[model samples]
Target: MRSRSTLPCCITLLAFALPAQVINKPAQPNKFLEAVGRRAALLGREDGNFEAWVYPIKILRDFQLSVYIDNALEPTPLSGLAETVEVRPGHVTITHVTAAFTVRQTWVASLDKPAVEVLLDIDTSKPLKFRVSFIPEMKPMWPASFGGQSTGWNQKDGVLTFTEGMGRFRPVLGSPRFTRISEQIGHQLPDRTVMIEFEIDRSGRVPIVIAGSRSTYNEIIQDPDALVPAADTFYREFLNRTTSVQAAGLNPSYDWAKIAIEKGWACNDGVGCGLVAGWAPSGLSERPGFGWYFGGDTMMSAWAMQDYGDFAGARAALEFLLDRQRADGKVMHEWTQSSALLDWPKYPYGYYHADTTPLFLFTAARYVRQSGDRDFLQKHWAKLEQAYRFCLTMLDDDGLLSNQKGGAAAVETGALSGKVARDIYLQGVWLGGLAGFADLAGWRGNASLQSEAESRLARAREAIKPWFIQDKGIFAFAQLKDGSRYEANSGWQGFLIANGGIDRALAEKAAASLALPTLATPWGTRMFATDSPFYDPVGYNDGSVWPFVTAQTTLALFRHGQAAAGYRYIYGMAQATGLSGAGFISEYFSGDRFAEGPRAVPHQLFSSVALVHPLISGMLGLDGDAMAGRLTIHPQIPCSLGPVRFERYRVGDAWVSGAIRPAKPTSTVDIEVQGPTLKVVKQPAPCIDLQEVKPLTPGQRGQ
Candidate 1:
């Protein structure tokens, strides 16, 4: 650790680094209205089921939010007859005009409560009856019961409640008498159809409320009287959380990433708050995969949240994970929700991952880098010190992290599980942790630690190539513990590439080998080649396509000067978020070499991280050394997307924003930075309106 006498210097560095210790701008209400989707529409609220998906393109199997008209037997096919499906950040509007009656329905979900509000306007000549239904696939643990029949409520209560295990779903209306029970016989499907009859009485408006509850069962939650106001307040407060960032020259990946981050953002009663990887619907009970708080997820989410100016969420997630670190500096994988601890006996496994601890260090370093919050560093320096020490112990004489060798600790799934060698993925992370430690050490002026970390990083870099790089244009997954090797094209290449400072020819060959059509998907890179004997499209790790890996590779591509290729991967990741209309990236996709995946959670935090990172690190190329009061921007504009602007982007205590307009036929970029105190340390691109940054006054505005 650095000497305590240098504390004042650290404080001075931070004092010049940030505008204020805490941002105190009075946040006025934000009227957020962004329409983003392809086949399905994502309704985002900090409340509700954390997601409400509507399939407007093809309503054959719309997941959560569904609509039915008149005949329950022949339900209305919304996609086939739908005219318009308009989405705003606040609500979703779907209008369908048929030969008989014209139905216009608006779906508004509360951002503050566990409820959805729907307003329907019908225009018909004859008496028409239609029903609106909400069917969620609450898989597993459901030899269940449905209908408005809870402990005290009945069908006469004009509500629909489906309760099983510890969870409940209630869809209520004030003036309707609803009674329907279509329970799943084998619990294979959530076929419990809860519908309220809407008899078209001379084209009038009808309101409906769909409330979903798991642990929240208070008077306000149970009361039908408060649903409307709850929704109204929710929309107002929730809009403030939504931000609009035009990707400029890029595709909708930036927008989708931001949306997905919001979708997967979760908070549980016991575990406090963190980003869940994804919530996949299965035949088994709803399991929050590393949900309560996964160290990896928390670490990765910091990238996305920071890129999108959601530092509060990022900080919350970071603190949540840090609070649960084990004594010996091992960061546990997850701290599950109270429900997981209560409802299931097999969950809350703290250290299922060997990569998580290093990843935690990576995230913390990045947070400090972006936030310039040396104050945070000062507070957590000892924890960081202990973590690095633990890492040193984990390293073998060969410098590889050996704890994950031939165990369930690292690479826990697919064919890689229980392998007899250390995988390259661990090395990639080990390298990242080394880089982070060196950077932090340099910041604190710890000469001995900085020299040691640099030396370790250099030795490992030289050592890995000889052991892992094979002659067949590939990097071996690992050198087996038995002195053999596992030769394969692993997605770990991205991590190695992104860590930078690798041999150019070796890194280039490794990157090109993985880009083969057999292993690359437009959505994400496959974990293994399709021709591999162990390849399974849906295999946990063998052939699965992970969007986060795609993102990591995208950053690596940028580091290797393949910015255009990196942009394509960004497009693929953005498209994956639209698959379920949940605006969340799933855990992994079937490695059929497509961008989309099935059989995974819908909203992996790193999936969003995949997007958040590239926009800043790749495209805009903004690097901030808050400690040195230096900022740099390099333009990596692709020819296809044209010039773009990233407005109102935050950099530590200040906001440095500009547009990337093409300098015409020359293929150069005309970059411009508006007035700000951020001093230029390295700027290759031509910039306009650069200004000298002064220390921020007491009430300067920067959120």
Candidate 2:
């Protein structure tokens, strides 16, 4: 690791290198609001599923605040009761109103403690009592469940404690100063709830805190108010450590994406520490809808993590996956948080995905290229080599990676089923992995290994070319088990092009096909074209619009010089950020509407990355190799975005900040650098000469 003492000297050197006219003021923090009126009252019911992590041990996933005015048994609805919900980085404030009183509840997940705090304030004419319910499901995340689980509860003084799984989940609840408090435990059909009552005079404030550990419980009950502010400070400081974007069209959503990605970072005591797929309320389901450590999802989102300079978090994710690599060198697909209670690895679910291994290699190489962490590469080189060798074993006779060896590819359980022989998506990820391995070998001075990887990559590209059906203007989605082509034009093509390993002509053709209305939706690009035999608007993988897939497709367009066509999808994704949940992106949306499905998660990690990665790599056009000490800027900023500022973006050991103003002849760039010596390169690009880009026409069919 580099010495911290050298930072000042590097900053001094960078100060002299920066342009004289460029100046940057500290960017302001972003906030979001969800107004819950009569018409949009259902929006208030969407749970933020706010979570807190106390490092490598516990995670507190608490439901949204449910208020009960007077003596109502259940939490009241917001049709005419609540006004608005304001969501910030560290906390969420919900304002509930009635004819007799106005109650404001501020919900926070302690950054340093395994607890969640809800600060309550009431405004009324006389002393009145009200109830607030919290269902802290003291259970592990999805895919790992405890059979014959036992539960116990105890109440001492004003604190109520709930325990389960032999003290594995000991949740205690109480307040510091609120004296007039009483508690009740209600046995709901599916989930147990703890209801606390508090009486207030004309105007009073109270704190309702729930903690998972004794240390946290004691700390919170003593200084409950401090936890909320401390969490706010923690988020502000965390944001300072990473990058932020400032532009006209993109504000709060960009910052929201930053928090969305960071919130996915989870650490378990013995299992491992890394990024979970996403989080949602575990209402009646065994899992919180993909709330488990996934190798493919983590590696996929690590690109966005690197885009915003969260190198440490990204590295930790890589280490987490490395610790779980199978004996045969294949990266494990998914590991649940509840593995400690069961024999998880003995099951077949961990290595079910064909793409995770290659993604591991690809993401690792990308991390090193961006952060220039050669020590990491050196330490993990053996495991990475093993993963590369494992990839070689999966290649079919045609040289393309087959999905039938030991794992499934793309569509897991949808209308498109059966064992896939070789899919373009897997081939694209494998090619990227091969390219990454080649680069790593070259860096390690292994010329023979580099040559072998390069030769195999060339062969894979040749194998994939025949899969493209020229008459259809798109590539075959996959080759079936019977050696027949499934020639449905899919958004999966975008995944192949995003890696830049495919032929330029083929990428252009795929990008053009992506523009067809059969695949492109008003919200985002559908996984499958609407006209397909297996098209289902709400199907998980058939026709749903996943933000990550949309992002990859849009990024593919930008990579192949389809800038105008790509901007529409990017804009649609940004808009979707506010459509369902404030400061969050839904996991998937219907191909026909702007809404998410019944079981869709409101705050998804890769869905958030859809906003960050595309804006950085696609719009800002930045590619950095810290080891080479070179930072290249090839911007394709659309005219609709107006002037753009990319602040505090990190390239290896250096902090790069820049401003872009799109123009006809040429776009102007004002950049500043801090930390490390670096060479800046500005590549020539097609001059942008368009006005505000509008949304694409809906319901149009493809040729």
- lDDT top scorer: 2
Displacement of residue 372 (Cα, Å) in model 1 is 0.6
Cα-based TM-score, every candidate: 0.74, 0.87
lDDT of 1 by residue, 356-449 (tens): 7776677777778877877777887888878888787777787767744312333666565666467777778888888888888777779899
Error of 2 at 542 (Å): 1.0
C-alpha lDDT of residue 479 in model 2: 81
lDDT of 2 by residue, 135-197 (tens): 444445444543323333343445655455455655556665334333333332124544555
TM-score of 2: 0.87
